[model samples]
Target: MGNIIQLSKSSPTSEWIDMSNQGTDCFLELLIMAANDLEKTNHQEKLISFLKDQKDINDIAPGTAGFKLDEMPWCDETLIDDASFLICVTKEAQSESVLSKLPYKVNTEIVFPWLKQFAVLIELMITASER
Candidate 1:
């Protein structure tokens, strides 16, 4: 069993996101929920689109993720290093200082759990920003 990540707005209602394939959408949703709108810049938009593309392809063929982590035409992010099942890449997103770089891999199995924690990070950043 995987861990549970809970989230809710200003209501009595709540949602529990399981930290696994079932919560893939939650990760993608969290990317969208990020406070800075990456879509505003054409380059940033491409990065966002690339993220969706990689995730979709990953859901279909998990092994193909390694090849997809190459140089992006729209952004300066690049693969800094890699191993048999992992790829480390440059981080270019605007974020809270807790992180100096973006997650350096394309595997959903890895990303989902990391994203669960990232969701909390984003929520805290957003909540703090609004205050």
Candidate 2:
């Protein structure tokens, strides 16, 4: 198994405060980099393929499934562009249903795919999270 690195050390509270500030700065920088890349390559087919592969890994299909989030989780790390959109599968068919509320311009609907074997739906969830 891989080892995990703890971000905090058992140190003085002042040191921890400094570390927290540094960590937040680092996170913001990473988020900015990710946003730049997302915008630069938003229309690239490769990125779409990458997203599709991730969706498959998460067992996300084109139609409704058990994994659709009732409340859409916003992805704070990603910045959406014109091509940036959300993909989800839902069987619910009410006006107030989760799927129906998604913005029409950026959301796509399809049947959910069955997973071969895995409890991890992080791929799709992360994609949704990114949106």
Candidate 3:
């Protein structure tokens, strides 16, 4: 069976989002999209660097090096807070995917109200970058 990553705003809450099915590919796509936006704004260096780091992390063998969200740098504070939320969620999802390989299920819970705000933040960043 494929990995499953479930996220909730907090414990005791009835609402939980399942991001496992989408897998890390979805997160990578969004990051690439964000990186593309950064590139259009003359942030080529940051884009290249971030992509390289992502690739390096992905290439590492499992149980050798763990994924870290804070390692990814932010060029602008405009979306830093929101982007950080997305990054953390993505990291947790990726970690859970690996942990799911064992005979156990991984369910992650995040305390932030990121689900509803994530879409808005992405839109805002995209719109702002277009200017």
Candidate 4:
């Protein structure tokens, strides 16, 4: 569907993650860590399946964008002005100018409670990568 986004890592680490015990506390911690780690690499391929490639960010407002990894939620990165998804990245991580060009908006109200599940899923992903 158009509401899909896929991201692929060139050199995915060999790590496996577990989600059986994923909850509020565990998910956020791991997610922040994983995000930090992913920022280290260059060329983070972001594919917006819901919108055409090279389309204007305004073209896809309020749409769910899927990730290559199904375990992760369909991140809604639409922004009223511009995408701020890269704001979550740390200074230590790689600085990709492309991220700044992407339209992103943070949904704290919607995303706050889901941090736990996010962390748990990351654990499973990392664990699976390790295997």
TM-score to true structure, per model: 0.33, 0.19, 0.30, 0.29
The Cα local distance difference test for each model comes to 0.38, 0.27, 0.37, 0.30
Which model is ahead, 2 or 3, in terms of lDDT? Answer: 3
* Local lDDT at 35 for model 2: 32
Candidate 1 regions with alpha-carbon error over 4 angstroms: 1-26, 33-39, 66-70, 74-131
Total colliding residue pairs, candidate 3: 0
lDDT of 1 at 30: 41
Q: Which residue pairs collide, candidate 3? A: none
Roughly what TM-score does model 3 have, to 2 decimal places?
Answer: 0.30
Q: For model 1, how does the per-residue alpha-carbon lDDT over 54-84 read when each residue is reduced to its tens digit?
A: 4575477543432212233333232111110
Which numbered prediction scores highest in TM-score against the true structure? 1
Cα RMSD to the true fold for all candidates: 15.4, 17.6, 11.5, 13.5
Candidate 2 stretches greater than 4 Å from native? 1-19, 40-131
RMSD of 4: 13.5
Q: Which ten residues in a row have the lowest lDDT in candidate 1?
A: 81-90
lDDT of 4 by residue, 3-117 (tens): 2222234323322222222221122232333354443222222412212221233234323322334432333333211112322332212223422322453333443334433
* Model 2 pairs in collision: 61-112, 61-113, 62-110, 62-111, 63-110, 63-111, 63-112, 64-90, 75-129
